[model samples]
Target: MNTTPASSPPAPVAALVQMTSGIDPDANLAAIDRAMGEAAAGGASMAFLPEMSLLLDRDRARSAPHIAREADSPWPAALQALAQKHGLWLHSGSIPLLADDGERRVNRSHVIAADGSIRARYDKIHMFDVTLPSGENWTESSAYAGGEALTVVETPLGKMGLSVCYDLRFPELYRAMVDRGATLIAIPAAFTVSTGEAHWHVLMRARAIETGCHIVAAAQSGTHADGRETYGHSVAVDPWGIVLADAGCGAAAGDGGYRLSFAPVASAAVDRARQAIPLARSRANRRITL
Candidate 1:
């Protein structure tokens, strides 16, 4: 079922959905449903959404009860149905789900097949537990547990790597995925306004250039119900560090609300980038004898 880029089609298009989810799940799903339809209609074979697509409530105590379980959660089933309806691969950026202890939660990512089945799942590894320079305190570890394993899965777009918001800060994870033959990496993020403005584009470009893989990032933009603001520049970058598509500004800036940006995730670009850079292979051949 797994195939390399050489064996796949030439231009495999992907859609990145930029959203501003509130505390309400039903309303958010409605928005996503509409975006999925638009992506499919636009001829995208796959769609990627941002982290916390379901809910973003500031009160941890109030948000605890809303966490869903994959085994029984309607969100997965709903997403599966959406993928099946659109006949497209769907990558959910991240969701807060009940963890092993049933008390703690995990930031989980999902890859849905065209037939409405979950193909792969990845829990977020990094926890955003720092106090920002703006005096905004966040302790994600207090509410969510870190995932243990790296996730790379076969898709129509070639080998795909999965990660969440805070995980983007770590380059080693992307390098590891590249070593595993990943040609595309998806990072679903709910990056804060302060940090996103400072480091979002640079980090994304760096990852793509270093790995020679396309970076598809869907982001949460604008202010949310929790009074927290997000820098909303959901972008798609090619392997050569070029931004193929961007959401520009928020929905208020004349961009359609919950709009999906379509971009070409071509295998030829990956092939050319790897051939030109060869960094992945170069690292493997490096020798250091002690």
Candidate 2:
């Protein structure tokens, strides 16, 4: 997934941190810090860490206190400090932040400035409450409150819209995001191998095709220590629906480690060029009323 960054203005260079996170928050932060440092050294303007960046527990009870909140929270502050230290924009994937109920948490995402400021926070609107074909049931609603808002934040790159993993399946969400002027979208995820194999790439490409925006999906690859396996081919899809880079994740890839990881930094110059000549805009509009 390596590509040379042609000479241009201060374009956005986004590095993705892929992980098979264990139950420990500190360990996960340490891994993220290391990867972020590498990204900065590699000349990245912005870096995105995958979802469940803080804590991933098959058991919900043990993961509640670790849910992040506020500017001073360790995870948020840690990313802010890292961004400030490296002078880069940090898009931290959704963390479970504490909410009104002591037991329930808000699935949260944070956008931090290079100067150590919290720019925007997006709570994951779509919940992963489902029953997969493998009979793996996920009831995210029991532990989280659904966000009743569409979050699109202005970044140095462009209008970046926020949506967590499961939301990728719903094109209407991405359509609404683009209708509001989103030039780029982020779908940070911890997609299961079952669904990831079946619908991961197809759904993502469809969203990109429908929205006319670049999709940068930083992912959780490989098997988790909790016995949950994720589909780990983290990808960056162009507005034209071409996969610019697919970070590899195989069975022998470090055995739940970050081996086949890639720092696929895309250029704004090229992205703008794609948006300048979108085929979706010129086509006849079809009206579908339910």
Candidate 3:
């Protein structure tokens, strides 16, 4: 008698890079190049970068100067090459793309295939516009228009959802992605140090527990050229809400530069987590609309 064989489960290594990206795209690219190499060497099959990976200009007046179109941007081309060279899926957290008006830009995320092709592109749907208790204010809508679509992509790791930094605050978005079959979610962020200190870990773990999906979050830490400081604690969480790895900055590292961290991602973990909770399936029939 002949028996059917069980298919191999998906288990891919994911690397999340934490950075202190400044105004220079070239400098950022160089840092990214080294980090990617380090990640790949550590056996990572996929790598995630922080938001505004290409340029993090604090000066609102000069933000648009580094914005580039996907096709025309040297950053994209170089990133594609890096992905191809490492044979890894590269998730650029978010890049600044020039808008038609030429005055504002779009915060876009791209997933590059191991073959150097773009698998998916996601523009950030939610913009960060808030006034903090520290008297810090941000008006993201002034320079970057919000994206209207939710982006998900098929990859060797699993079905992945793409989201920028600010999008993490909205649990509805992650629920919607789970409805669309996302097993892992990418949250590339540059969260303010103040907010990050208060809520980063809790929020990250909350999303993982709520969605029953692995969370990959890369962040920018330290002060930028524009005088804004970001909280840097890049991390990966398992579907079971366990912290797989955390790239702690500041006192932990004692330096202000770039750091790369890795964690193992397995489809079986996702399966086990969902099987235990069964929340997604239970909510499948309930449609909640705004």
Candidate 4:
């Protein structure tokens, strides 16, 4: 009865759902609901949603079920329902999950099965604490607690790694993830228009090339009412760092991150026909310190 191989890889062809969110979680949920319906109707086998899929607020822990939305929160129920309804696996790239410490919140990413079961949870380890040149500043460490461990889950898509918006800036984190057997990565971000235009695609491509993994990055593009301008170039990159699909601004003004930021996690359907380029090979021009 045990005829299956222990090391068979998963299928390729992942779907990256990009969106634009605001302060209202309910409206955000409604948008994603409609988006998911459309994506499913379009024959997308899986979907990946971006960070703050349910809520984007300066207020602390408002999106967490226990904090603001509670059980009545539409995010969990809707995500579960959407997955079950479409018979697709969904990756909630990040959410305002209740933190281990009651005082703070966790920027957590959840992996949900088609049956509405939660397979894994990854709290963002690195926070986006930066003061941009344009006088815009974000202090994520103030209201949120950082995670200590990394998360990699086994799925129909193979080993799945978790990451959030600011995490994209840290390649060592991704390097660590890929070394731990992550063949596919999901990046859900609300990146600033400045950084997004300058480094977003380059960073995504670099991560994929270094890890030999396929990446599906869904971004928040456009200017938000919060006076924040986000870069909105959602991209899907292959293992060799080829950007296959780029959600460019058609007629949208400016490279704001709020053009659209809702996204989903699809199954890891990668073209493994390409050679397994391990990160070890990237140790190019290493000195013989031994």
Candidate 5:
């Protein structure tokens, strides 16, 4: 007879939102409100949104008016109100906010508790400064200053680590999150179609397998008003490197309209995966030659 104790508690349901946000914050907020309602109705305790959930305007001159300090931005307050109304925890993918310097902006993500209080915030550490083979060039550093520290917070879902798009390529960040006792990580992204098709799935699975943590990557999808096309495959991966759900890409996803997908996040799954492999212990004992 097989007799083994449960590793942890039962799983919680998480809702991942895939959006194609435009320049209008009001329209975007309306979409998010509807999604939050749906997420609550679907039994999701927490909802994870894609990067730039509030606004996604590439034109600096046009987006300038909308991007302001956190205190001045109405979007954050609206999101908090939505969370409170739905009685659901919210992982606001990323919002563009003017930095303290008042000249540059920061891609910031926030964790809002169920009661409408802000729990934690994380600025995207990595800037998208690459020139794609398709002749698409993005110099995020020119407008958005990179973050200096990592952020992790406690929630009903689990001890959560936060990161934004472009940060996914750096495995060291995920490793550090695991070292900090994070059982789940949220990587909100707005991936280009070309890059998403090539690396999104592999990186998502790799991060999950390496850290033994549930990975929820809410993403932006479809063509945006700014004339950029993003790959729309919002995905959730388990600690065992298994895909729990994937909101498909292209026209099937309403060309980046509102799409909500649900996934299970169980602490027991994390514990079981870590126990089976014990990578953390092995790494702890490894010699560093730097």
Candidate 6:
């Protein structure tokens, strides 16, 4: 009987891309191509992109044509080509696609292998339907349906959990992912300037610390053609909650501009963090009495 456990994969370098996407899908694809090329040249095994990586148009009337079914849309094929061209795996942040019902869209993420094949897909489970203190209202649920299942996939970097913007507020989702053996989690977002400045860093570090998993967040930055502003600061954090890299905000992430940052994803770091605290063991032993 073979009882030996599978060994963890070696660490791989990941590239985080912070972009300021507008309403144009073609331009966004070009930006991604440029970034992927740079990531490959810089020795990144995989590249992570921000949410709404393709089209960020909030105007339903204008974005309707672009938010077609995944099978029908050309964007996925285009992205596959880019991955194959760069010979790198790609974590497509999130794209809006028409749901099966055809009445609403779903915010979905794709994990593409180096061979240009899609290994996994995750739809954003949480909806951002808040009216910020700045009076900026966002009703994501109006246009998008929440996803039903959690997604964790194996990559050269490690077992990765996928989540999109607004999902960060839900801790249970991340805990569930950790229970499923995710050593790293991706939280690609298009955060508003106001809430982002308040909770982005704090929440990101908290997730990493609580799960003992590395957190890689690619973000959208600067003002967009739709008259909305996003918080930049694309960041990568280790399992110990240390920020490995952060692409800062403001002019450095101006509209139509993009920034790339790199971080090392190692199983050793996950091992050290989990072994130091052993939170999982403690949680399993505890009994919650209401």
How well does candidate 5 score on lDDT at residue 277? 96
lDDT for position 117 in model 5: 97
User: TM-score for all predictions?
Assistant: 0.93, 0.86, 0.91, 0.81, 0.95, 0.94
Residues 67-177 of candidate 4: C-alpha lDDT, one tens digit per residue: 432243456767888789877778876778556547777887778888988888888888889998877788999878888888888776678788888888888898888
Which lDDT values do the candidates have, in the order given? 0.88, 0.75, 0.87, 0.70, 0.92, 0.92
Which candidate order results from sorting by TM-score in descending order?
5, 6, 1, 3, 2, 4
Q: Candidate 5, which segments miss by more than 4 Å at Cα?
A: 1-10, 251-256, 287-290
Pairs clashing within candidate 1: none
Residue-level lDDT of model 2, residues 165-230, one tens digit each, is 988878888878877888788999999889988888988887776677778888887777677888
Query: Could you give me the TM-score of model 1 versus the true structure?
Result: 0.93
State residue 187's C-alpha deviation in candidate 1, in Å: 0.3
Which pairs clash in model 2? Answer: none
What would the TM-score be for candidate 6 when compared with the true structure?
0.94
lDDT of 1: 0.88
> In candidate 1, how many Å is residue 216 off?
0.3
Put down candidate 5 lDDT per residue, 162-194, tens digits, no spaces: 999899999999999988999999999999999
Model 1, 12-46: lDDT tens digits are 89999999888888888888888998899999989
For each of the candidates, the C-alpha root-mean-square deviation to the true structure, in angstroms, is: 4.5, 4.9, 3.2, 5.9, 2.6, 4.4
Error of 6 at 230 (Å): 0.3
- Give per-residue lDDT, candidate 3, residue 181: 93
Off by over 4 Å in 6: 1-10, 250-256
Task: Give candidate 3 regions above 4 Å deviation.
Answer: 1-10, 100-103, 251-256, 284-290
What is the total number of backbone clashes in candidate 1? 0
Give lDDT: candidate 5, residue 3: 92
